[model samples]
Target: MRVTRPMLAVAGAAVAAAALAGCGSGGDAAAKVPPTATGSLESLAAEVKCKPNIQTDADTIRQAICTSSAGKFVLATFSTDRGQREWINEAKDYGGFYLVGRKWVAVGDDGVVTALRGTLGGDVEIGTDHHAHTGHTG
Candidate 1:
């Protein structure tokens, strides 16, 4: 079959749309703890010096007001990656740094996050953005 210009254009548009659709939260936004984040709350708290103060939001999310080598800020973690990926995509705008492990996301603006990211091997990665958050991930 001879592919006409219009046929090529339609195929190209369909491919482009499919590619864009694949690049999202994957499914409906349902919150849950990712496997990696199950025990990460405690670890992150210890690392960020929020040990005695870590606050859990429904056991699926953890947050704390902590101070560390990087500075003082709120550290948050999500059990599932539902919205975490999207958050990481736009984190720099809100001073977001993510350490994704399997299914969990640990977010902060501490050197520890950067350090832990190295240990992730290759989970999920986001470039540090410091323009909005004032503190860079590194």
Candidate 2:
């Protein structure tokens, strides 16, 4: 039996759709929980009275916030501490900033507020203060 190109494309699309449906159904029931509402990073920084100095290696922080019983709803992750700090400093320079649950949050950069994943829980207040000196300034 020979399959035409169109037939193969249709079959592939059908399989992809089925796989996506299965995966969606397999999601955890707990994932439905809404993220926490930690105030903006800017507010946290102002409370501390220091510009954030975030680190470049902040995976530990992301895990802390992502798994916390109190703030697990946010689901943030930081590939690097430098990335996290860059967001904070950008927020300070701009304005609009808000925390999503505990893990990930958003801050204004350039002309838009962007969400960043894998953030440290404790560093939320300090923003990037702890990581600023570790040479992660990008």
TM-score of each: 0.41, 0.22
In order, the Cα lDDT scores of the candidates are: 0.55, 0.40
Using lDDT, give the best candidate's number: 1
How close to the true structure is residue 31 of candidate 1, measured as C-alpha lDDT? Answer: 24
Measured by TM-score, how close is model 1 to the native structure? 0.41
Candidate 2 lDDT tens digits, 1-138: 256888999999999999888778744432433333354444433332334444333543432222122222222344445665555566544333444334345332311212222222232232333444567657
Residue 13, candidate 2: how far off, in angstroms?
4.4
- Which 10 consecutive positions of candidate 1 have the poorest summed lDDT? 27-36
Error of 2 at 73 (Å): 14
Which residues of candidate 2, in runs, are more than 4 Å off?
A: 1-25, 28-31, 40-138
Candidate 1, which segments miss by more than 4 Å at Cα? Answer: 1-40, 47-49, 69-73, 90-92, 110-112, 118-124, 127-138
- Cα distance off (Å), candidate 1, residue 49: 5.3
lDDT of 1 by residue, 28-56 (tens): 32122233433465675564455435665
